[model samples]
Structure formats: structure tokens, C-alpha cells
Target: MKKLKIGLLINPVAGLGGSVALKGSDGENIQQQAIQLGATPQAEEKALRALQHVVDYKNKVEFYTVSGQMGEHICQKLQFSHSIVHTTSGKTSASDTEHAINEFENIDLDIIVFAGGDGTARNVTKALNKDIPVLGIPAGCKIHSGVYSVTPSAAGKLLQKLLTGEMLSVSYADVMDIDESSFRQGIVKTKRYGELPVPMDLTYIQAVKQGGIEHDELVLADICADILENMEDDTLYLIGSGATTKSLMDELQLDSTLLGIDAVYQENLIGKDLTALQIEELVADYPKTKLIVSPIGGQGHLFGRGNQQLSAKTLAAIGKNNTIVVSTKSKLKALQGRPLIIDVLDQNVAKSYKGLIKITTGYHDSVLYSITD
Candidate 1:
């Protein structure tokens, strides 16, 4: 078989703002602020994790990437032979990502694998316009896009299957994004930017986020009713994002951060749109705490997609047993046999959550779901 040619690109500052609670690293100002806030670049490390899975195929693949932080640094560290097709500055920008995509389009690559979030996905979509197949490594704060693999290692494994012709088809996946300003204000205004041609393997690639699920209101009400009935006095509850969990806050007649983390204590809102530090502080203050989270509609991710405010430290402090997973039965059925995934960026914390966990689906109903790292 002929060697597969792959184009790789990394947005070095993709996920810098996530842990700092900046919401996203979209503009230069946010990037600078995130760095000042002690946020470190994570895209390169995530890209390395994805690449590590494909290391055995080094001799069977031809690699092309940009110079320096864009891609060369990681490729060199992994000792992978790749030609530098483009050069970028120490600090890259959206234009650099677009330029790199354009360069990749001309390389006759079998696939272009990128490491970043929704913004990076949008840039690639705008550049290629669905002319080439691309995959994401999920290294950003906002990953509403469906082009990303379920995990970094999953990306590598999927690419290996694609190269070997095990995965033979592609499907168009939505590239979604929301305004950062509005997002920080606890408002979720997601827009469908475009679509990218992605591999159709559901085991590896995530489906586009499903909207218009308001029809599940009755079920959501039941779930909230259960949570409300179980509320304990003098205990802190960390409410996570998503419409389902927001229903719980709605039932309590409290304001909800639709896409951010909020804290409720003694049936009252204590904090809204909190940062990781703020959450840790709250956890320290209220040792009796429980985290109420709802998984992404089709992805089955209880954390690490949009709610970076709930950092690994916060989850560890909350304890796995203290975490409550809420979802509609239809949502769980959509998984089609995939385990609920956890990507806290801390392997120890993620691995700590093994075996089956309970998910509250209705007022008096629950299901045992397997948790995976």
C-alpha cells in the first residue's frame, strides 16, 4: 500500500484560557490576559499525545507541518520525519492557521490533522471550505465542533485506521462557535459557522452537538425534581453547564450560567460564572459539596468540553461519588454503546473514575453507565 501523507498543525495558544476561566483564547487580548493569569499553552502537549499513537506508522506515513510552535517543535521532539512546509512566528494567529490550511490543501494529503478548539476548526473550514478532510485533537477551551476525535489518543488511532483503509468514509460535521463576551455573561449563543468533512467512525469521531432538545423539557423537569428533592441543607452544589442542568437552577428559581460553572449553597445561589480558583475556594469553604453535571448531548462527556471552570483539582476535591450525572434517556440512548468519556487533562484524576457510575435520568429513575478515560 502507498504511504499516507498527513498534514499536521498546532495552535500553540489554543487552550491557554480554559483553566484560567477566560472562556476562550480567541483574540490577542484574551491570549495575553490568559498568560498573565498564569495559563499555560496546552495545544502542543495535546498534539504530542495524539501523535504518539501514530508513532509506529512513522515509516508508513509522510508528514508535513509548519515550522516552530505551529508544528515542527512537537514533530522534532517525537523524532518524526516531517518537512516544514510553512514557517510561523513564536506567537501564531488565526491568519497563520488559515495560511497553514491553505498550504496543506496544496500538499495532496490524505488527511489534515489539527490540534485546537472551535476557533481553529472554523479557521480550517473557512480556508478549505470542505475541500479537504480534517480532524481535530480537542486542545481548546470551546470544542462545540464535531470534527474533533473523542480524545487525543483516539485521534491518533482513528488516523491509523483511516491510513490503513479501515475507516473508509467521511461525513460533514458542523463547526459551531459562540461569542466570547456573551459566553462569559452566562448566555449561550451558538452559531453554526460551517461544516468540515470528517471521518464517519462514531467510535473515534464525535457527532455534531444536537440542538432543539427543548422537547425534552418534561424529562428535564423530572430530573430537576429529583435533584431538588435530594438537596441537603448547608451543602454546596456546583451546577455545571447545559440545558438539562440549567433546568435544575430554573426549578430553584435561581439564575443559571448556561455555559459556565455556578455554585449553589443551602438552596441559594452563592457564585455565578466562577473560575477554577473560585470553585476551589468555594469547595474549601463548603467541604460538603456535590457536583451536578449533564453530559454533552451526543458526545457523552460529563466534563472537559466547555466547563473548564470545573478543573481537575475541583473534581478531585468534589470526589467521584459526590458528582451527580444528569441526562435525558434519549440523550443516553444516542451514545449507541460508547462509554461516558472524561478528559480532565490530568490522567490520575481521569483514571480514578473507573467502573460504572449512576446517571439520573428522571425523578425516580437512573441508569448505571460505564466511565472511561
Candidate 2:
């Protein structure tokens, strides 16, 4: 086993409070709207969770993190030692994250780990590309990029594998981001930058961008409808819209959240409005709870964005083993050769969901179709 030296960086406040409770990230405009929504900063808590996962492997890896959100106190909490960048104070800032990446330039390390959304990925890329392998423990609300694993636990598992030499350590994960403000209006626009490496055992996360054209949604309607019909009763369905899932909701005579996760069961509207708690409550009663959702049109997100309402709690409660995706052949073709991406709050659930996912649509003469990645 090649015990590799590692560094840790966390964007503590990256995607703390999103649409569910807080208004979410402030856009080109200031974060005023987010502030007004009684939005509290969740970066510390989120970063803490992501860091906890990293610290689990403390005996095997050394830490080279900046202070504060970048890697200060959290490392201390786990009783792990760390190295700080010379130019930086023990204090960390957004610029500190920039500093952390640059500092990696002078240091010799095997891999780097960080916690944040797509914005953090873009920042890290400015410093390390394939030259240094990095892994993300999902912490941000809008983690629409491919550089992260499905969840934090999965990240821990992958890291453990790398340290133990159980898995090959040569490959890359996609680099991507999302538009924070536009995401609030129920839009998730993403773009690809490049790739980073890690062992391939983990579920590869991808970045989801904004939908391309609204005009083609009508064509997607029938496709969404067929998947809706395929949904079993009493199962928890987390539907996404790009015309496909929305049209499916229209056909079921049920109104999809359109931009959130709406719950349906047993021919009854169980929860018109849902949050992570409500979803957990519903799924607990039905152990067989299944999540029926779809990828964003052009961005091709298997989760997040159009389904942020599904929160990590809900995804965990429903279990990724029970999750489902729906997409049209045309939509799948648009992805080129790239696989779909889904970034949610829960790190463990994200990791459990790997391998080819089965998509549900309709049949002949119907917008129904089946697509997989």
C-alpha cells in the first residue's frame, strides 16, 4: 500500500442554506435575498460533516490544510495534526482556499481533499488539475459538479481503498459548476471545465447545468408521463422536470413541484409540500420507498438542481438502492459520451449509488423511453 500524503480544504460556507430553508446563494446580485430569508450560514456545519469523514482515516494520511474553514479547528476536533501555508494566517478565507490550492504547488502530496460546491471546484482547478488528485466530500447545497463522490462516506471508502492499495489510483472525475442565483429561480445551469483523479470504485459525481431550450419541453412531456405511469403505488417518487418528468406529473393528474421533490403514494397525494423531514417520515413507513427522478436536459444531472428538495435525509431514508432515473433517447444522446451527474447533500447515499442506473420512460407511440449511463 502506498500511503500517500494528503491535504484538506473546506469551503465552510459554500452552500450552507439553500432554497429549502434559506433563500440560498446570492447571485450576481448580493446575498441580500438570502439574508432576508433568515438564511443562516451553514458552511461551518457542512464543512464539519465533510471533515468528519476525512478525519476517519487520520492514522493513514497526513493533513496539509489551511486554518478555519479551510482546515483549522475541524482538524483539531479530530485530534489530527496539520501543516499551514506560510503566507496564510491560521485564519482561512475564500482567498485562503485560493491560497490552499496555490500552497499545494510548493508542497509534495499524493492527494488533496476539500468540501464545497462547484465554485470551490473551479477555485481548486485554478491550482491543481490532473497534476494532483483531489476528492470532494459533498458539503455545499448546489454541488452540481463531477469532482465529488455521491456522498462523504463513499469518499472515505475511496480514500481508504487508495491507502490500502485495494484499488488502482489513476483516473479522473469531471470538473463542473452551477449558477447559484439562477438555481433559486428553479434553474440549475452548469458547465464542464475538465477532470481530476481518484480510484474508480466510488460513484463518479457530475456537474449539472441549466436546461438548454424551453421550447423542446413539449417533446419531453410524453416521456415524463410514461415514467410516471411506471411508478408503483406507495413508493416515494422524487420527480424532476425538463418537460419529461413535468409532463409525467401532468399525465398522473398530479402537480410536480416542477423544481423540487414532490412525494406521491398509493394514488393519494401524500405530501404536496415536502422537506427532508417530511420525506423521511413518509419513507420510514414504507421500507420499499423508491425515488423516481430524471436528469436535467442539457446539464444531465441525475440529482440536485431540479430536485434539491430531496435533501440528503430523504435520499438516505429512501436509500439510493431504491432510486430511479428517467430520460429520453434524444436527451441521452445530447450527453455526448459523458455520464450523468448528481450532487445531493448526503455524502453516504451518494457513494452507495454507483454502476449503471436504470431509467424509466414509456413505450411505442408514447413519449415513454428507457435510457441508461
Candidate 3:
């Protein structure tokens, strides 16, 4: 049987700052700060999950990867047939990613699967010399790009389809990246770096994130009023990141972290820019807590994009029953008919929240919506 040649690249520190509420893990300083705040690197574990789906086809596939944490580690851990195409020492950077891809160009491969966010996608675009198909394992704090699969397991399933010789369409996906410095300050500045050839499958690949703020002031005020009027005494409110949720904090006249999660009690600010662990601890103190979340404008993701502070465990502690889904009518209209996506990287947890859900669109108006994995 002819073996499938696959290229793999892993960014070890891709999402080190997410659970720590650092916004992103782009620079060396930010990564260190995340570590100080108890953020653990999960990119390698996510890569392992993606590779696990293809392990059954070990005899039918060969992998080309870089040494150390970039790719070789996962390949070796899984005992898959693989070749190290490049070597790196210490911590890896965008330069290493570029050089690794340069080496990948020398070998013929079916597809290049990389684990990171939009930054790694930019590096791949910078170094790629051929139009080979590429796919992303969403392991970064920022995933505004369209090249990534919805989740790690989804990426593995896509690879499994390729191994089984399933007919899949190949197309181009935009490689988009945002200015992390500006993102930290609550400003979303996104740019289209380039494009990559990717397999077309909505079930796996995600759409580019929609950036910008809504201009409907009246509707926002109504939503905020409804939330405040219904506020229960002594209950903790976890205000999630996003412009819609920010409006609620603004109505309370409290300090709001534009792009970070905050805690509120009786319309008073309690915690600003909280981490997952911090949120879990705080949830334990409150007898009643509600998590207010809004979906990504274009992608319709409720849990995964730019809100890693709400880890799987945190979501469990909050419980879906105590959750509030807020969105503007226009944002829902933009989805046309697609269901809201929940990609917390835990399939079982994501599945538990699937099905019809209620979304608060205005002060007295809410509609039943569908949630999907």
C-alpha cells in the first residue's frame, strides 16, 4: 500500500497565556508572565489528540517533522513512522517555524498540519514554497484565521478522512493575524497576511473571525437594562469578553476589561481580567453565579475563540443552566442559518451544550437558537 506523506509542525508555547488571561502568548515576556500566573502549555497535548486519530493508519502513513517539541516529540510519543526534517534547540520562534517550513519544502508531502494560532499560520505562509494543502490545529489564544480546524480532534478526523482516500475538495483559506499588542489593550486590529491551500470541509476548518464593534446603541442599552433589572443580590456575574458583554459592564458604570473576562457582584466590579483558575476559585465562593457570553460575530463560536479563560473545568463549574447567551439580532442574521459553535477543545463538554439554546437579543426579546460542535 502506498503511504501518505504528512508534514507536522507544533508551536510549543502557542497558548500558554490563554488560561492565565494574558490575552495571547505571542512574545517571550508574555509567555513568562503567563507561567508566573500559572498558565500551562497545552499545544503539545492538543497536537497529540490530532495525531491520535491517524495512529491506526501508522503503516499507511509517514510523517515529516522537526526535532524536539515542534513535531518530533508527538510523532515519537505515538510511535508513528516519521522523519525529522529540521532541528531546533531551546525555545522555538517564528524564525524556527519559517526555517522548518523551508525544510519541509525540500520533501514531497501530501499536507502540512501545524499546531498554533494565527501567528504560526503567518510563519507557514512566509516559508511555504509550494501550494501544498495545509491545516491548522487551533492551539493558540488568537484564532482569527480561516486555516484552522474547529478543534484538535476535528483536525485529526480530517486527516483520517485523507488517509482513507476520501474525496475532499482543496481550496484557499485566508491566513489572518491580529496585532497582539493592540489586542491586549482591547483593540482588535486584524490584517490579512496571505492565503494557504487548505482542504475544504466546514466540518473541520473554521471561518475567519469577524472583527469590529456593533453600532446599535439602543439595542445594546436594552440588553444591558434587562440584565441589570434581573440581577440577583449576592450572585456573581461572570461577564465574558466581547463588545456586547462589555456594554453590560458599561451600564453598571464599572471598570471593564474590553477583551478579558471580569467578575461582577450586584452590578459592582469584583475582578478584572480573570484567569480560568481564578474564575473556578471565585465560582466556589458564590452561591449563585451567571456567566454572560456572546458569540463571535462571524464565526458564531461561543466558547473557544479568544475566551480560553473559560476553560472546560470552569464551564462545568458555571453549568450551562446558569449561563447567559447575548447577541445582537444582526450578528445572528449574519450566520444565515448555521448553528452557534462551541469549541472548548473538550468534545464531550461541547456535546453536552449542543441542541436548541436561548439567546438574549434585546431587553424583552430572546429567540431559540441551535448550538453545534
Clashing pairs in 3: none
Model 3, poorest ten-residue lDDT window? 343-352
Best model per TM-score: 3
Off by over 4 Å in 2: 1-3, 17-57, 86-93, 127-130, 166-174, 181-189, 192-243, 249-258, 261-292, 295-306, 312-360, 363-373
The clash tally of candidate 1 reads: 0
Q: Judging by lDDT, tell me the better candidate of 1 and 3.
A: 3
lDDT values for all models: 0.85, 0.61, 0.89
Lowest summed-lDDT stretch of 10 residues in model 2?
Answer: 364-373
lDDT of 1: 0.85
Candidate 3: count of backbone clashes, pairs at least 3 residues apart or interchain: 0
Off by over 4 Å in 3: 346-348
Candidate 3 versus the native: TM-score?
0.95
Q: Write the per-residue lDDT of candidate 1 for residues 1-373, one digit (tens) a residue.
A: 5888889999999988887778899999999998887777879988988898878887888789988988999889988879988887666788888898888877888889999999899889889843678889999887789899988878988988866668458888899988889878766678999888887788888877766445677898899989999999978999978788888899999987787788998888989878888888899988599999988887888778778778788888888999999988889898887899887668888988866999999998999999886
The best candidate in terms of lDDT: 3
lDDT of 3 at 48: 92
Q: Write one digit per residue (lDDT tens) for candidate 2, span 155-194.
A: 6666767766675546666677656556545555667777
lDDT at 55 for candidate 2?
61
Query: What order do candidates take by TM-score, descending?
Result: 3, 1, 2
By how many angstroms RMSD does model 1 differ from the true structure?
A: 2.2
